[model samples]
Target: MKRILVIAIPLLLLTGCMHLNDPRPKHYKAPVTTVANKVCVIVQPEADEQIVTIRINEIGNDNNTLEKYGLAVIASAERCVTDFGYAFTAGKAYNFMVILESPEKKKRGVQPSARIYGASFSLWRLNGKLQATPLY
Candidate 1:
């Protein structure tokens, strides 16, 4: 439809113009802090040269809507493990998401690629270690 194309074309063009040097997060919604306790989260890219974003959500019980708990941007490949400093309540469910982006190709002066990849996982803490079971 015309309405769909009007919005989609400009979005595609804008993303296609994104450069590889723009590795920082444009905005963040959650106020998250970190601690060096007996907790850790590991996220690795399936391919090299990608931007990574992490989102933590709480699975609903009485309130069935998942609430966003934390958001983080991991730019470039340095370290993959981070402690979100959130205390995981026993017997509760949480969702962990890793979003990867490569708005442009690895080389300069080439047409922008504008690709996004992601993986979602169910989180659990067993025996003082964190476990992430992939959902997708």
Candidate 2:
């Protein structure tokens, strides 16, 4: 009986010393790139300021994830005109078709603002090179 207790206690204590490493994946893979469907921009001329509304429709498999890309395109458009002396005719609205790059993976849109839209376009792409006839 004494021998059994001594051996059992040692075995039980050794079991707690064993270590097990985590087996989960650690690498991060970015979403794949896909072609955007439709792109449009609306420039509203106000008395004091011009409001630019860039509409990027049909972005990726997920409808929500496009806003980030949309804002990026808007910023690029603003910067493009600023850097290259591009501006819409004053007191007039303008429409344009743009091609944007987007990721294939679907992700949930997390913007707090309900009005915010996500569209993605690079400075070069938004440089009036890819403009098409207005769908409207």
Candidate 3:
């Protein structure tokens, strides 16, 4: 029993050490360009009264090349409050996420341009007014 216990402990320690050398990239890259004109917002009905979720979609062109970059919380909250009207309680916060679609690239004569489109956003709410904060 003592021999097995010694062997198992060292193996466990080695396994734990192996996890410290993870190879995945730790940083996030920002998008190169954003297509503002093509955008849409969808609200999801929630069973919970305290929390609400809204999904914002930034769509690409006719080619259907779309990529979800991230969410813009403040912009979405403002649009929702303006268009949908605010009936929720003041100080009640909502969660928002942005869905990004890849835009079709156009070649402007000899130069080929690639546009990186994505989304990002933060928490928001309406407390006598609409507010948004960009998430990091």
Ten-residue stretch with the least lDDT total in model 2 = 25-34
For model 1, residues 18-131, the per-residue Cα lDDT tens digits are: 876665533212211123323233434434334444444556743432223333344443454343544455445555444444434435533332233333345556666556
TM-score of each: 0.37, 0.20, 0.28
With a 3 Å backbone cut-off (N, CA, C), the pairs that clash in candidate 2 are 66-118, 67-117, 67-118, 69-119, 69-120, 70-118, 70-119
Candidate 3 CA-lDDT value: 0.30
Point out where model 1 deviates above 4 Å. Answer: 1-39, 46-52, 61-72, 75-83, 106-136
Cα lDDT tens digits for candidate 2, 1-136: 9999999999999888665432221221111111232223322221222213333222232332212123322333322211122232212222222223222111233221122222233222344343333212
- The candidate that wins on TM-score is 1
> Quick one: ranking by TM-score, best first?
1, 3, 2
Task: Give the candidate number with the greatest lDDT.
Answer: 1
Each prediction's number of clashing residue pairs: 0, 7, 15
Q: RMSD to native for every prediction?
A: 10.6, 18.3, 15.2
Encode model 3's per-residue lDDT on 16-70: one tens digit a residue: 8975635332222222111232122332211211112233322222232222233
Number of clashes found in candidate 1: 0
